[model samples]
Target: GGGKPLAPKNANNAAKNSLRVADIGAGTGNLSIMLLERGCEVVAVEPNDAMREIGISRTKDKNIKWVRATGLESGLEDSGFDWVTFGSSFNVMDRSQALKESHRLLKPQGYFSCMWNHRDLNDPIQEVAEEVILELVPNYTRGVRREDQRPVIEQHKDLFDTIIYIEEDFYFHQNIETYIAAWKSVKNPYWDLETSEGQELFDKIAYQMRHKLPSEFDIKYTTRCWSAKARN
Candidate 1:
């Protein structure tokens, strides 16, 4: 049986009292769906055309407003949102500008939440996977390092007062195909490689992993969430 998925507890909490919420970089409306389910009016902002298409299709219920915009240019009204959230997309943003924009778009006491599912490098399989990616993929940018929380919070000290929550040992199970697809979706460096070479590396890695661990493949991740109310 598939394992139960872990949801962003912080985001869910923010949605409790929020009337209007914007999910920036909400690819395919993953987080947006949750907010909508919780009775918050959600706007799914994405810059990529394909991603926006996916989000639109996924959120056909007309409750979700899908907008093509980035963090720097959300195109929403100033002080228009009760909450703003970034789910696994904060690292792709210009930290200073995004924080400023987030603050600008929120009403007084509006909440801002950012969440990331971090791979636990302590696991042997996960460690080996990281090593393989670093070795095979050139100029790999590990997006955001695990240690970036302190500096990021410090940099935004004036925008909002911080509250940090960590959910450890969140388990995820994936079959080989699902694993490969999910990895390819978020791997920035792998996208740079030619299609043929990328496929080759992907196949090689999957083959090795299957041989190494034939049974159920499970990995643990730490879900880190930061939330704060906009400083008046």
Candidate 2:
């Protein structure tokens, strides 16, 4: 839920040594950590102070450069990175601006990728959770993360070439506490947790989750990704 773990199809390419990567909106360095594990040189850009601090603390012993920057303005060197990636962060940015920034930050023919781990709503466990959400907010939508990114990337045809899309299903096993914590971290577009109604909605969802979910269970998710080569 809270965790966004991605296993790319091109495992060999990902593990190539000395590959320079810029992880935009790199919240708490999840993607950055993965990249480092694969022997990558990472520039993690996160604008949020709290998240960046945690990221720094988490990777203090590792080789990483953390910068305070947004997806639309990474302030990174031009044509410096072999790959520019956004892990569950592209939706929060202006997609067009972010794409331009990605183009600017990557070497000619370098790759640009953005991905999100989406809960499998068709899963039995997720169906129960969805029931709770729709009951509270009937007009609730899954938001931009679920949308196809091809059209937007295609719009920048001058900046990027043909897109490659990947969808892979995986299961994450976790305790109820961890699962609930994931929900807490989520930014639900339909409800504001700062408001009383939002609090009530979360409480209700939590209560139902506690009632419905086992202490330990597996949640199904599909990691959807879109990538393309940046053109000069």
Candidate 3:
């Protein structure tokens, strides 16, 4: 899970030609827009109203319909979509149940793909950021990845078969302030910069970077995707 989940690149020619999709846990509709750009009609399901609104406005995809729903109970009919995608939000979900729901939603032989933009901490600047973050919150754990739940999906082989992939590079560049803001903007459950302790740590990170780093930084990321072929 890295670099904007470049798994979308692996979309078969048929998916590119036309696809009807259910974008489960679609936060900010980033992936939905990507799908819409490919001429896919999408339904973006998100539980948080604020997050859903942000996604709806951000994507502005006419092909996308936003719905308030969680991954396990999407409030959508069965067998309606060719694909059910969990973009960057699969690990946090009750994935076993979510996968069952995805199976129910997808048409016969439909696809399920989960993707993540893994931080390219391998780079020096990114590594520095990681160091600062880990130093501040010793107990902070990165959210789970596909590997964490792959067994659950695999064990219940009647639902789907895992799709394998090779790592792909995805780069995004931003100024120092923008980078700081992005981290600050991370939601509360993930990391709460608004809290006193959190704010102090964030300030420390800001001070170090602002004093020591250049205005702009190039971030390298690795996008990983775990896809599956859904079964009845």
Every candidate's CA RMSD:
6.5, 5.6, 5.4
Candidates in descending TM-score order: 2, 3, 1
lDDT of 3 by residue, 1-232 (tens): 1112323444465355467889988878878988887768799999877678888788773767899978887899989988888878787777888888888998887888888777776788877777777776677666566364567678658989756555688778989998887676454353555468777777887777776567897888787877778765
What would the per-residue lDDT of candidate 2 be over residues 34-89, giving only the tens digit for each residue?
88887677899998887899899999977699999778877789999888999998
Model 2 scores a C-alpha lDDT of 0.84
Q: Judging by TM-score, tell me the better candidate of 2 and 3.
A: 2
Candidate 1 structure quality by residue, lDDT tens digits, 45-154: 89878778988988896567988888789999989987889888877877778888999999877778788777888887677776666666656666673445546656
The TM-scores of all predictions, comma-separated, are 0.79, 0.84, 0.81
Cα shift from native, residue 163, model 2 (Å): 1.5
In model 3, which runs have C-alpha deviations exceeding 4 angstroms? 1-17, 146-149, 184-213
Stronger candidate by TM-score (1 vs 2)? 2
